[model samples]
Target: MNNRAARVALALICGAVFGFGLSLSGMMNPIRVRGFLDIFGAWDPSLAFVMAGAVGVATVGVRIMRHLSRPVLDTEFHLPAARRIDGRLIGGTALFGIGWGMAGFCPGPALASLPLGLPAVAAFVVTMALGMTVHDRLVVRSK
Candidate 1:
């Protein structure tokens, strides 16, 4: 396959694997996710295990990537260059965590649940898109 085709195929495969993992881990369920965040209430610790597993895999993946000179389908790693932690980073993270805790749906799981045809999911996706667009125009473009 050509480089572009290989990249597209890899992205699709990765997305499918991610969606399947989310479904199997019950991350697609808002109740379970909210339970995970509710430490003072009826908290569920199972999501912590899932997060740990993901982090462990990511740690190993990063180590493997560090050993590779370049990606299989790319000329370079194309990793993020930003290293400084500023107010914008902290604010963005706080907003993201608040949103996730409130809605029990991060972007990944929210997108994964899009096929369920739920009005809540539709609203979440639309709001998320508007937020992204606003950030792009106000923050990213200004940068």
Candidate 2:
């Protein structure tokens, strides 16, 4: 109906499609994810195809978006202003990688797994939220 409502509905549809794709591709499976991360041992490469497909799609999307002045839903194309790598970026990336490797689920897949009603997923989500809150508070305090 309204612009905001249409944007919200579009977001919901996009998220649902993303979650369904993650589930269908076993990206929501911790074992499968860990297997993909494991290179020396019995590794699984199935998710590589998924990653490639996603990259391809994103590449095309980026190219297409070049012709547009702003996003379809929003008035402006919001992007990160930071262009240089810093210690904070390095540390955050390392932390994210460590968490992903240890838990076998990044933010996207972890959230997608929430609908499955798994205790482990719930714990991961809770801890993830707590970690995010702690990080935000620490950043604000440091500032």
TM-scores, in order shown?
0.97, 0.96
Off by over 4 Å in 2: none
> lDDT tens string, model 2, 1-143?
99999999999999999999999999999999999989899899999999999999999999989989999889999888989999989999999988988999999999999988999999999999999999889896798
Residue pairs with colliding backbones in model 2 are: none
Can you give the lDDT of residue 127 in candidate 2? 99
Reference-based TM-score, model 1: 0.97
Model 1: per-residue lDDT, tens digit, 43-117? 999999999999999999999999999988878998899999999899999999999999889999999999999
In each prediction, how many residue pairs overlap at the backbone (N, C-alpha, C within less than 3 A)?
0, 0
Residue 108 in model 1: shift from native, Å? 0.6
Candidate 1 C-alpha error for residue 80, in Å:
1.2
Each prediction's RMSD over C-alphas, in Å, is 0.8, 1.0
Off by over 4 Å in 1: none
